[model samples]
Target: MITAKTMATGLAFAVLTGGTYAGASTPKVKPNIVFILVDDLGHGDVGFNGSTYYETPHIDQLANDGLVIKNAYMYPTCSPSRTALATGKQSFRTGVYTVPVLEKGNDQVSIFSRWTVGEEHIMYSQPLADAGYKSIHLGKWHLVGPYPKKEMEASWPLKKKLGQPKPSDFSWVPYHKEHCKAYYPEGRGYLKNIGGTYRGDPALEVGGYKSKTGGYFAPFSNPFMDQKNPKDKWLTDHLTTEAINFMDEHKEGPFFINLHYYTVHRPVVARSEELTEKYMNKLGDPKTGQGMETGKKKLTTAQYATMIESLDDNVGRIAEFLDQKGLRENTLIIFTSDNGQNIGSNLQLRGKKGYIYEAGIRVPAFVNWPGKVDARRTETPVMVTDYFPTFMELAGIDYRGQLDGQSFAPLFKGEDKALQARPIFWHLASEYRNGTCSIIRKNDMKLIQFLATGELELYDLKKDPKEENNLALKNPETAQLLLKELTGWRKANNVPLPPNSSLPY
Candidate 1:
């Protein structure tokens, strides 16, 4: 816990030194915060991060205008990542290691002791709301409730299935309505929630990911979103318009907009025919090989590209709205994603969404506050859990709670050695396309421990960005030291492990 006096001193220093950065000046008032969280965007998807396939001029401009973090990380899947962001705690504390029960397995093989985040945990929005900031949450809220109620469990979808039920085997919403209502964004301190709900993806509300429109287009089946205008054809555009309206209504003072967009996720559909044709042409060019060579089919890749473009367009709209309202100088914007790419390529990354590898955990991130944050690229490592403490520090709130993340607030003020060298961890006890595992990354060294087989894979991330070589056998000392630390962490946190699994440490 950071003492109030220490926090005050740090904030005062930041305020006084705002003029140190080029083209930056101190602001007289509190800065409004707009956190834009995109779904399933990879580390190499944005133009600023070297993606020639998908165009993202607006996102690139935002990164150029702010601090781009080179080594940012998140959980392998959405639920754990969002849970970590909301509570600033690891999944072991919240019991949301992966997607709900389907990926969690039945009682015979289940690893998770709990399925949803408890109502007792303090969310990042609570402190902001207490400070008189009107906050709104838009799009996917998968943190609420993912497990079925006790009564509903009598008709458990996989009560008598074979060995273990796959995630695709279950299709119905498993949560009780009233039980989950208390965990919604509104109950958790947001003043308003536009499209947030227990549903993980847009397609879940209409039908399983195969629905024609998959709720990406207008006439969405999302019960939380109230559509009034007939011109609101695309879901991304509609969410952005709502966000602009909220900003317009609250233009007088400080506000917090948690704009979590459910774009480029599963059920990939093009926002418009024009955008689809544009990507098709771009991919068909000889300069960039056709989509078929990229693992995903050409049409699917084209549709996914359109989704990415639509997200970028909405980001531009928000940026333009801020500038038009004269709120650019006083507003803080953060652009990031939940996890790695789901449908499209993850560039040279080792694995995609559900694997506990570089591609699945690492993500692209940038922070823009005009004068407060320096416009420079940094190699400092950051995590999704760090956002809560960072936001609390920026908001000038003295938060005295148990958090597993360190605040990277000093990095914004051009402090290169702000965060200390410490071991960061990820524990995914449940299975999600990969086996149960725990990971530890300290400095440039990373170790992945497979629970079932007790196999260890070590990599020096500085040399092996793609994680092609496993150095566990070659460099036994470093791997053993990391494993010792990881085991100590799990034991201290009382992290749940799979049944009948053993750890060498």
Candidate 2:
């Protein structure tokens, strides 16, 4: 295992060598990629990341047999993180700073800059499809703008018009199908799309977003997904079945499966009575809050655990199916979550889903390829934007695009110094559950600048992983350096600020 001291030395060497780590070349044969993105899963929610309450044997096995990325991060929320993953660009570049609408009212304080990522940006799937890969996108694809007119009008009605009072106004255009259809998974580049739509949650077709089950238990409301099969009870299981069937049909050669599961996100619906009962027995009682607390109203810890277990079970099913089809050897499976845990516990990490802290941005991540990626844990910080270039490198695609991330493909070949000298960034210009802020991390030191208040917070993550102590005042030079870099990055990327922000610095 590579220690921190060795990694620091590697960082020094990388800095001197112009940020390049010497490692083995890319694989000759393009491996089949199975990128599994879990919605709202926290860093410590999995067994591999030290979660004792949630049993994730399949996920744990993958981490044990593969490489676990200790410092992988995403955006504070789902939309921006998914945007970075899909487009290989920062939120500033894509103009998707937060969710579709500012959750916390869009007044003069906060403004929703862009409803959805523009269709002009090229999705990662396009390059993969061009490289002779049969790609299929299953489950949630929230990159598309807002829901259709009916759902938007009913659920999220625009009380006061901000722009012109016409139907063609830019502010009122996101609710239409014509605006969103071009950004769906199929239009972006995936050969097939199942259940990939604008809806962020699994709202049922009958009662809309407030449906009892949230469309988790059959009769899914997703118009993009085919619901002809009566045996499809759980949404997770249904998506997994579709993934397996797709792989089975295209088992001849290289294929890409973007299996983004909507499990453990919202509504907190249990997969089955048996699993719920099992968790209830283990968690004591939900009435008195005796077990794990989800921090969400009407969401019990047992129900949350059941959702996680269901996800793990389906992960195991996918692995088993791959093994059965003799595709496990050459298939590269990347498992990770979009953001932090919203309902369940994030272990000892600070903050929740919408905060710019460890719990909100840091997520559980791992890369498993039987004989390719060796089993090891590395503290090389990787962002969601890095996946696209990594996939391109692995597939030998010479992409010449404006990407805000560097490929960490060398790390898969046991190059621990691949990303030690790199600095990852996050820009949240809109306020939701947390304030608008921009964060930068270089090595073990991280600096967060609150845009609204211009509060500078610096923490040495190696010493204080939970960000309990602020080192900005103590380490003035380091804080200033990081702040300067952060400001330069924002200016270079043309990052917009909240209307109520006061950057005193």
Using TM-score as the measure, the top candidate is 1
TM-score of each: 0.87, 0.86
Q: For model 1, what is the error of residue 417's alpha carbon versus the real structure, in angstroms, after optimal superposition?
A: 2.8
Q: Which segments of candidate 2 are over 4 A away from where they belong?
A: 1-27, 105-107, 147-180, 206-210, 283-290, 293-299, 416-418
lDDT of 1 at 445: 94
On the 0 to 100 scale, the lDDT of residue 151 in model 1 is 22
Q: Total clashes, candidate 1?
A: 0
Candidate 2 C-alpha lDDT tens digits along 451-502? 9888999999999988999999999999999999999878765577766888
lDDT of prediction 2: 0.77
Model 1 lowest lDDT segment of ten: 17-26
**What tens-digit string does per-residue lDDT give for candidate 1 at 319-381?**
999999999988999999998877767546788898889889888899988887888998778
Model 2 — TM-score against the truth? 0.86
The C-alpha lDDT values of all candidates are 0.77, 0.77
